[model samples]
Target: MNRMPVEPPRIPRRNTGVTPSPPFRDRLMALSTNLRPAAWTRSGIAGGATIALFGWLLACAGAAGGADEVRAGAQDYRLSGEFGLSVHQVGDSIVVRWMTDALVEGSLEVTTGAGDVVHRDATEAWTSHRSAFATPAEDSIQLHYGDADARHRTWIHLAERDPRPVRITGVDSLFVMADIHGEYDQMVGILQNAGLIDEELRWTGGERHLVALGDMMSRGAEVTPVLWFLYRLEREAEASGGRVHIVLGNHEIMVMLSDLRYVHYREMWLATSYGLGYDRMFDPRESILGRWLTEAPAMLQVDDILLAHGGVSSDQLAFTVESHRDTLAAYMAEDLFHRWGDTTAFFDIDSITFNRRVDFFWGDRSVFWYRGYSDSDTLTAELDSVLEHFDSRIHVMGHTPVPGIREVYDGRMILANPLPLGDEILLLVRSEEEGRWRGERFRAEGPPLPLEVGHPEG
Candidate 1:
């Protein structure tokens, strides 16, 4: 008698906070095992796909000249080239079919409007199906075929003209996330459920901003997607007159200087496991990430609220934009190989020492380092001094991962670590009154498991 094959159980949507089943673990292991044999096979398939796609693209390019085309504007152009290929949107999937005019050998490049390269296929017979995600901001998609004599390209806009301003009149709310550690999917789910991001991944808040207290990279498997999502969100928010503040965290500095050997072996393991290639991945020549990181401010002021990663030092008590900028510049110029390299303002090796009364950036010790210390009093004093200097009553930070939202110094400083048990935890900051901001903590309660930490340095 023949037996039917067992189907792998489906993993429930993570938003419900339901613990993943043991079968899910088994399934993941099985999938990984199955992938090993097909690794080279897939590479070959990708190569074939690339060639096919580019070949078809070139054929389309040949026909581009004869299509009913219009130069919409300086930046906006449309061409409906004639091709034997069929292009149509069925439900949420875009089905594209075309025959290659001539056998071509190369890769295909799809460039997005924000200057981001999306799909790079290096296979023969390129064919792919992508979901049609709604885009709120003005965006364009470009298809590039061949290296030389290969100028085949198509651009399409995926946004409505004159989009309505994000409605935040009664919202008066802000979302605060910390220690995301490369959990892009979870973060997006939380934001979408909370109404911070629309279904199309566009910002929906008016006059409100989302404050991420830092540590965005260095863990989880999908750091690239996480950063890309945030980058898009920042642009969308700015377009809608809202804002997104990404505070610099200690881990960020570690990832930035990973090439200089400032990061640890374990952190490097985390980076590699999560697909973060520190040295070879980020190109110092282009320096996009470096430029973005250098521009990130140490502290951001929203109404009367002060937001920062790690914490503030005593010297930064009266911190201004100019002062922080100068300090950051000085720190960036330091040589990591030197003895005094770690002592720079930007390099905080001893997290505990940061919040010390005399040392500055007061706290018990380096929170990430986790040295034994019970100097809460000194930390409180330093916090008071900072509050007085800034003239702000509340200071919010996310360096230490607390079990839940912790109110230290009688609510003067809030320690918000949204990655409790390496699961999902995010804080919401809402404007209760004209000038008052309230911090609300949300936690996903379920089974406990070790979170994979990705440190790109390794």
Candidate 2:
């Protein structure tokens, strides 16, 4: 189900006299939010593989064809025919919306963990409508939906919970890949060659940490499958005691709000053909990939090393590492497009209060958008200053594409975005007794390739 719409249900609506907010319309206005777009470089190897997967798209065509009679209650529903629906739990309210052909009729029944009905509504006939309900005090909600005859019945059980932090303190081995840009084959090949997963794509990295340093979306049509695969791998790795951390990147920020400059046409086609806008197809509250991505961090730390999609400047490190993580995590948990304007103060490079305002998600100098690593000649001192602010030894970044995994600033900063042109991974092995970290580059074949070492001449 990489690209199909999720099953939907109806629910009670709050009759607020005032007009409600628009559907994902608001965006934060900012200057120079993204760096110059990297030149488009299509992988011949990736293109061949991508062509082969078109059959997969055809195979999934049936799921998106539509259904007429649908029902949901104790179990999740599969949307079929002309009826489509989605639900979002926002701030203690259950919001539901639907799209259906004319003369379609359905009923919505919401209940607590017990069989007690909390809210119920019936539509004699509906073309399409949006509704919301004040959630009951129960921790779990059971939604039941069907027509008047109840022949097309369906059930969905939802539980509300806060996002949890995924911390990795003691890990002997860690492998990181970044800037996937919808290059699914390249991502899988590197993971398999690195022994992170087997040919079946099962997790083989036991107790090790596999971190995807972000920019997983945009630039290609395979975004849906690429993200779903990563979501699956995350679960698989967790079962084997290994961890997969997906840090957010700028491209992710752009796509969430329908910024389409770099988006591949096929993605937009698939989404629109299904009666969904590009952003709606991947809405954080509706799509599995979107939901998983929304919970990921913009900045993550393991021991002495800090990793983010883009490098975070020293000034942005004003807050304690935990505070930085918590703040960014909270931002991603909500409607990010609307809430980010409050963070403009942190994006200012010339701010006198740079250390006081923490902005991890936006702006050129923020964690997910900074480009100082590639532009600066005096990177060693520059990186040291940033690391010193966070009490960290090293900073690993991924927004800037390089020929291969390279260490600059005397190994204080590592640039790990192996573009489609060059497929590579950075393997970091830490020695607990020695209190040191060693890094190497692993290409598709042969032994570990050592990076070009040495500090730039002062």
- Report the C-alpha displacement of residue 382, candidate 2, in angstroms: 3.4
After superposition, candidate 1 runs with Cα above 4 Å error: 1-107, 110-172, 259-277, 283-285, 333-378, 421-434, 443-458
As a whole number from 0 to 100, the lDDT of residue 200 in candidate 2 is 75
Q: Candidate 1 at 348: error in angstroms?
A: 23
C-alpha lDDT (0 to 100) for residue 208 of candidate 2: 86
**Candidate 1: Cα lDDT at 312:** 60
Residue 237's C-alpha lDDT in candidate 1? 79
TM value for model 1? 0.52
- Candidate 1 lDDT at 336 equals 25
**Per-model CA lDDT versus the true structure:** 0.45, 0.59
Backbone N/Cα/C clashes per model: 38, 13
lDDT of 1 by residue, 1-458 (tens): 22111111111112312122234334443544534333332113332233223322322232222223211110121111111112223344332322233344434466776767665654353221112222323345655543233444544433323421222233355667777766666787667665667877678866577876677765343454455466557767778877776666655654453312222222232223224444322222223344344456556665556667666656464456446645554555444212121212233334332213112211233222221111143466777777777666776677655545556666677666643423444444555565565555543434322222221111
lDDT of 2 at 72: 15
